[model samples]
Target: MSTTAERDPGKTQAWGAHAPTGLAGWVIRICHALPGTSRIWYRLTRLLRGPIKRAPVRPFDVNALGMELRLLNRGNFCEMTALYAPQFYDVPELDWLAAQLADGGTFVDIGGNIGLYSLAMAHRLGSRISIHTVEPDAELSARMRFNAEHNGLSINLAPVALSDHEGIATLKIDARQRGQNSLQDGTANGQADTREVPVNTLLALCQSRDITRIRAMKIDVEGHEPRILGHFFDNAPETLWPEALLIEHVHDDNRLMQRLIDALGYVEQGRTSRNLLLSRASTTGG
Candidate 1:
């Protein structure tokens, strides 16, 4: 994989030019220091979308989940939202997921994007745990690697999409919204740009890495969750199951995946705005 600096010299320069400094640095600090201010700043960003979009991609440095992260301010919604409101970006879900690894174990982040969840767990758990972040997008995966190396954190990155079968598949890329990229077929919506990414099942990934015990896992594979999780539940041994799971429920239809999880001995512990928090029945006293 090519380094970010090698792939885009201009982006490397933008990193220096857009470093959170002076007024921008002050605003970010204030947002972190004062509760609700981040939301206010987010609202302002929405109000000034035109100028913000027209400006070059900026970088914002902030302490999120106890880790100092340099987040990009354009293209990717996850990074942009985190840049604007680190304080409120999935705080409850992150807290709950982080708490599950208090004792120390492996954490897996599917569709990791820019490694927000994986990096946070690494920072919080330090050397006590291992992290595996899976992202197929070449650019996003490179950014994730850059962020991990930038922070001097160790994270195993798998640049492939996980599905029910092992093969090559088409991934729809929404350049403007990188997080919305998916493995589903057809471009009826006119999303012409697509990439062919390698696909593997969850069991294959865990087996290859010798990951027999997972403390927690967060999977956000757009709308392909059901296929992946269903295959894992059917093929993986009980010992290989994660104690806790944070599954993105926004893409689920009629709560189909939630019902499947329930049938597999996982109980819903809670629900965030975008994810359904679940724990193995034995672990959660369900």
Candidate 2:
């Protein structure tokens, strides 16, 4: 069949299952200590083994959040890069997102990738807060589910891709795709085995599901943020307005970002290195 690696729960290998930890786990923990050549050599060797026969159970137990995160080989390796090498994001932002705890609110994480922030929030916050995480990649979605369950949190996991519409679209897969927000370049030179999925707009989802209050929101849709933001503004009903928003602006299109903020009646709050934070206008017409 379809390899089933992404769908089989029994295949969800933990980091501790392999080494004293495991080879993958140790590779992740001591990755930073190794020299540049050694790091390259290690990753190449691991990659050649082909699609993680057994996933390493690297538990990124964020003590502050009271949750344990389980990552597969690919995710654990990326975590190493994010934690030690600091690619695409910084440490301060990671620390800030990890520290947040909600009493009883709605947190929507679009392009949540592998539950890095979603799991952290679910763990730190009380069980009252409802988490809605959407990820398109099957392999990553399966692992996200595993992490949520492992942490004893109930997140409404949607495996379908998110967009302004509800239909199928092609998804490019690149080995370099980092984080859950990873997407293929969407160009002719992209990688292979790229697939498509039915997409659902946030507005439609909220309208259909009766999502009234959005306490916090995070969007990391590669380069499709503008399209998503446009649709959100165009179709967002009166009842659904998020209090705080965090989105990645990888394109450097400041004008578009500003326009999106203005359309949504939100003012700039702050920036977390790579992402911009916006808050609902304190004095919107209401």
Candidate 3:
């Protein structure tokens, strides 16, 4: 087992507020002494991260030395074609989520990339809470399903797209890196052909499925969060709202996001590294 001392020197320096100078650092310096090793090291490190599995809990636990996470990714879903890396969003997001759990409620993960938090909820929390994971990418959806099975979990995976309405929509896929937030808007670099799918409002889908009492939600859809949020608010009952919302605030759209969330009647409650977690007023009559 690697102790904190034997671990990466950079992390040790970061924790101690000191400059790193050690055998590992010297080795790295020597490696960099060789021509082109620096860029090669950078590229290699960037290419593979981990589903670095730890002891199996309910949802799979992983520590890439980034953040401690309890979630699932397809065992086959290794990081390929660099793209946008999976950040530590799930760690704090899941911690906050653990705090917000209502005894037996539903948790919906819109734009669930690869079942990280969704699987965590199912594994850690169990059947007390229902889980609905929605991912548009077919490959990612497959991976999510695989991870679910790998963990013997029973999460509902919606492999279709979710939007304001039902219709044929062109899904702009960043084919080279499917995990990067691909959009329906035709602006992404490697968008593919239009695929039509039925779009259903969150409330409508919940009602149809007889779902009640939502505990929390995690939404990361690059820049389309505003639109998805708008539709949810438009259809949701004023009283029935998520206890917490962990959303990605990617661009410098603070004002825009505030306006949109305000339209939904959410006040900024808190923030994690790249996400905002909001809560409804407790005083509001449910």
- Model 2 RMSD in Å is 6.8
> Candidate 2 on 15-96: residue-level lDDT in tens?
3342323453454445434444434645644443343324432233211224444433333344434333322223445444
Each model's backbone clash number: 0, 6, 2
Query: TM-scores for all candidates?
Result: 0.85, 0.72, 0.64
The reply for model 3, stretches above 4 Å from the true place, is: 1-89, 185-195, 252-256, 260-265, 283-286
The deviation in Å at residue 38 for candidate 2 is: 24
Model 1 over residues 89-135: C-alpha lDDT tens digits?
A: 78878889878888899999999998999988887788988999999
Given candidate 2, what's the lDDT at residue 139?
A: 71
Among these predicted structures, which one has the highest TM-score?
A: 1
Q: For model 3, how does the per-residue alpha-carbon lDDT over 161-279 read when each residue is reduced to its tens digit?
A: 66666554556545333456445632234334434345556667777777766777888766766666667777787666776777878753536466646565666667866788776
> Which candidate model has the greater TM-score, 1 or 2?
1
For candidate 2, what is the TM-score?
Answer: 0.72
Candidate 1 segments exceeding 4 Å error: 1-17, 21-30, 36-50, 60-64, 185-192
Candidate 2 has which clashing residue pairs, if any? 14-56, 14-57, 15-56, 15-57, 19-22, 113-180
- Looking at model 3, how many pairs of residues clash? 2
* Higher-scoring candidate on TM-score, 1 or 3: 1
lDDT of 2: 0.59
